[model samples]
Target: MVVESSPTMVTRSAGSCEWTLVAEDAPVLFPDENLAPKLLLERFSHDELKSGSHRVVFKLQTGNGCYYFKHYKISDWKSRLQNWVRSSRARIEWDHTWKLIELGFDTCLPVAIGEKRKGPVVRDSYLITREIPDSVQLDQFVEKVLPALPERTRRQLRFELARQLGIVTAQLHLKGVQHRDYHAGNVLVSWDETSLKLKLWLIDLHQVSFGSKLKTKQCLRNLALLNSYFSNRGNASDRRRFFRSYWQTFQTKKNGRPRGFQEYKSTLLTIEEFCDQKMWKEFARADQKWERGNRRLVILEGESEQNACRGVSELDRDFLKAVSQNPQNTFGLPLLNKSVSVTKRVTLKGEQGILSGYLTVCDKHSKPKFSARTAWDIGHAFIRRRLSTPRPLLFVEAKEQQWLVTEAIPNSMPLTDYAQSSQAHHLNFQSRRLLTRQLAAQLAWRDRCGFQDNHPTLFNILIQPDSDTFFFLGLGYLEQLNTPVSEKKIIRTLAAWTSGSLPLSGITRTDRLRFLKRYLLEKEGDWKRYWNRIDSKVHSVHSN
Candidate 1:
């Protein structure tokens, strides 16, 4: 079953550097064995497909057909030493591609490989493979193409795709191939329009290990990595279907018997545990993106020694410099609020074109340092939990004051304002109920993430009229809890939102009950008990 390609190797030297090229002898592409290396090395017309830190992928087109060229450059001593010890990345991928092909697994066809070395140290390497026509990355296909199809057709395609992925993954594990970076982006999905037949191919083979049986840990880790993308994009039922298919296929291959309900349940739980660990690691990585001196972020010192500003790399330095010098004077449009901090709406030009942001300046007596830092931390926390909030952009610290800049959410108004607007009257009963449910769900999710808002008034929340999306404001009032919020605290938050000087409009008793039901859906408590406590707290606050 293993058909090996007869590849011809050619070595060329220029000054003190050596170049080695090995190419498969395919008559259609490489008619001349020696010339194939020169052609690929010298004059192949290419368009860049993707570029990363150390690797650049190009799509090469010739008389034969389309091919992908993945070039890997070793810039650091660590990478050079690794390559010297275990050979180049191209060589590893070349071997792995052939093995996968021989095993009858769908993968890219490795055509040629080249390495540039000087005195046993590889400086650069490249791998060339025949491209799969009309194929897109699995993640892209799901996000872009699937939604455009008919509802019934999309469901059928998704089911088939999940089933096929499970089958292929199980076969790979049974054959002793473990893909370390087994995410959706590394997999390619292609489909026929006429018959709606789908095909999947695994690519990016360098990190994969061969001839090593997968242990439980290895299996769970790989599945978790794959699930990370789907966990956000697909629902729970989709994931359950995928896991069931995988379990059935793996069991059939290993023991020729189907797994029972308890066994499947146990396996699914283990997989979920691994997925949670993966998510935590991912959250840590996201947090690191905002660290000082990171490539994505920059810090700039102002002319005055006491003044300094930090912002995302894309922000224009001149804008940040102006804000660093005097933030209160930079934005003259005052925002309506009762806080002691000076808040204003500002529009600035940056590398990303025009940016509109809210600028808050806190003086020394108001603890500007703490205010700026807390706002920054809370903004990122909302992002980590996938909750909607204003994106924190820049922070300026000075001897007398500090400034924090956050992106302005477009087409949105404060929740209280939205409730009083004509838009509230336009909504039907069902729409109002849906909006209340969504708002309550967001609050519940925030609570589950161990965050509590000191002031849970409608004035601190924003709602977009068109999409009904909720965005939290007043980041300075947000706090992280060391433990779960107590029942008393939960009731107090509900009472604060309801019994403020300005009562929330358009919400009836029925709507309040709907909100409570949704908020308590995940909490471990009797709904009526929570409702009774909340009602008593609201009445007590009103009486006070």
Candidate 2:
């Protein structure tokens, strides 16, 4: 395959997931890695086919932006994955997803099929499809907007997004497609402030199930994951709002009366009603399990008597400890993915094309909590904590790197996906704040270290709700700079961050950070105001 351009602007949504685009083609798609994926490259490049069992994305660029050809391999029976043996069942699964995409019901459509010259569409089939540009995953929206908005505003945004999930999933289910794994990672949201409504787009349909006979209960159960994911984050308020909005969105007038989400609204309603008391009981139960086993509630506070894990060094052990401490409160039993060893010492979840997984914390100390394998899971928690308050970043010394035991972000999200949602409207405000303190922090860190921030990820910036708080979970990355982020740089950039005052000099790693830093700054200030008001309110809630 002759290469013309390499893919530049290589990024993931602000959400916690990463993608493996036919990145081999990235170099040929862009002369420099400065711009976001260009649609020009996606349209022009003709990639040479590579033989192997891999989940890959071939990004093509056009005039304004880029799109991608997501390639997923159909699990082959005789292939290395065959040892686990689902036989023809998995192949049937790929076909099912493809069939639905072709149905125009909307999904990541398949661009190519994986098959041997002399074989049937075997289990190990490869399906390719064009990437949806300028769209973001749900979590990214929260990351960008939460830190900048007031808690009230953040809750509103979450409810609206959750409402979207309810209505959209209900639509998908009504249409007969069950996203077996309807977790946050699998959903994408789109929006433009100029546009009236926020939109939801679904992706990663390989796990979807649809046949002549649809499983309503199982499908509805899958849809219930939105409730589970949100509830665990201590967003009971969001659960109620989501439930109400979901019910309203799906309510239909039948025989001259409105029916509340009949297809799955009942289940959604039941789950929503029990969301509080039931969740408390479960967390309490998980706590009891942890307490009996001697553990603690690290991320979330719960009444469950379970003991969390204890006596852990901030390494791989911390992850297990956190899991033991929290046990499994929401989302039921955690999923185990096929592991892949990256180096002799580490493996990157190694689950073929699976993007989302169970996030288990370790039994490490209270501060600088950690996991032996990776800190990706903490990234989400960091955003959650930061959204609610100014949580200190507890850094743990590991083998060679330091992992941060972060607070759960209030209405947090990933930058990668945030770029694609209606949440961006609120980010306009947060971006102003991001410019000042937060972005300044990076520049200050750089000045202190006397080095430059290499490959600053705009994807790293996070925002809180009511659009007030801000944080960068990639705290350790800045330490590598020749200098540490300085107060001067941060202060100077404050205006630029919020106003988009700087010329669109083009988004660089450092500049992008500065751009997002502006949003973080504004968010931080708002949060300060909120705390002051809350603190001044009658001494305390009890006093009032």
Candidate 3:
């Protein structure tokens, strides 16, 4: 049976069991009744477009033209039932492409669609669309093509492309069409030789949905997904121009230029805030779902965290035993507090440098209490909370021994090292003040987050050479207070800063008070009491 809806698109029945869609009266790609998608895939010369558990796509050449064939596979009863009720992905994409084209938007031309069903469930489905000729992905165009062009040409191309993108996005929103996966990879770019203009065609329409006039939050989400790419490739001014162009096109019939600075600023702020909030929520969810086993500690067996590390060892029982047994791999001297703390440095593949593993032991049997695994988890927590700290590489438990590996910070000295050295007196005045101010800000932030570091000391902070950035070393015992961090924790941290055993003995009460003002902000009496306590503690230690 055959049906020709258009000269380009043809729908026909293939053999005894298969339905097919193809271009220009072309023969069926799959003719065998016994053949499955996988077996059929191997017979053709094709480049894979995408391969996942649910669907697989390939760009293959046909007698008619180059076409993309996407095979949707149902692996389980749950997906089968859902797809059966909601319509197969193939039908959705095929219908959506036709609708979008009818709505005056460019998209890949659907050539054919097929579905092989079993009773009430769709077991397998396929969608075929003709490939756009002379097209490149927008990201690829930006990365490989734009940088090679002349400066003037590059600027003109970027501006024009951004303007066109703005127009299309505005059109999509105003028409109430929302692309769920609205990122750069789904957008295809082509240059028109005759018009001397650029054309864009959107793809991956299976998830596309239509609604009434899009709300501001919905529009912002779509914009943020697009902005994620531009934020990396384009400058602030470029992004601003893109948004401004979008607003102008959106308001073409409704209003003139922005009424005032405040309105314009508010729109920009909304976009920024929504984007940030959406991105953060995604990051947090990703972090939570990153592993399967324990939330705090998961054994790394070919997990992403292992691959993410620069010098990650192939974590296994034998590898852990080897690292635990070797002393040359150990950092610092051997076993003073054998049951308390131990560290080792492991070299990496290539010239990627080394990683250090520090373990906190608990008892005489060298059984760990807090453990290296805990430190690894806490390090990631701090990072997700936007605090600067050493990057944890891997954690492994072997023979009841635990190890945590972290990237080594180079050309850095502990804050205590700076305070104890002769260089302490000759330290740059601006550098010292800057470091102090940054420390105040970090402490204030910690307090706000209800964090109290029990071992707050100069030794716990590592200042990178000639940079405002610093890494917190004493994270193993970091605690979350049930209540907000009290004034006592603040005072205790400040007292550690003024501990007179080090070079800061030359610092006066006025200097301490001024430093406190940066964080405490106008708590003169509290600052005085904190300073007196610090002085009294130093005096008492000296008297003892």
**Regions of candidate 3 where Cα sits further than 4 Å from its true position:** 1-8, 15-17, 20-25, 28-43, 63-65, 191-197, 253-265, 291-544
Ranking by TM-score: 1, 3, 2
RMSD of each: 6.2, 18.2, 11.4
lDDT per residue as tens, model 3, 1-544:
1223344645455432255555543454654443355544675678997888898889887555677888888878888888757888888888888878877788887766777777766677887777788899998877556554555566677877887898888888777888988888899998743354787889988768887657776788888888765543455557777778777776864543223312767888878787766765664564565444343333434543232111233334344344444422432345344455455455432223333433333333454334455556667766655567887766544444455566677667776666556755665555456456566656665665456767667677777754456787766557755455777776677666667424654343544565676666423346566667767776665577
lDDT scores in order: 0.73, 0.42, 0.64
Worst 10 residues of 3 by lDDT: 305-314
Ranked by TM-score, the better of candidates 1 and 3 is 1
Give the per-residue lDDT digits (tens) of candidate 2, residues 1-544.
1122223323322122222234443444333542232333343654543434565455555443444444445444455455244433324434665576455444543332323222322323333444565567766766564444555565455666767666665556555666666767677766554333466667766577664323545544654555445543323355555556545544542321123334455665555565444434444454345434332223322225534223222224444344444433321334322231111111111113312222233233322322422332223222232222223322222322222334445466554344445664344444544434444544332333332223244455665534534455444332222233443343333322322322233322344444343334323345344334433431443344
**Per-model TM-score on C-alpha atoms:** 0.71, 0.42, 0.56
Ten-residue region with minimum lDDT total, candidate 2: 341-350
Ranking by lDDT: 1, 3, 2
lDDT of 1: 0.73
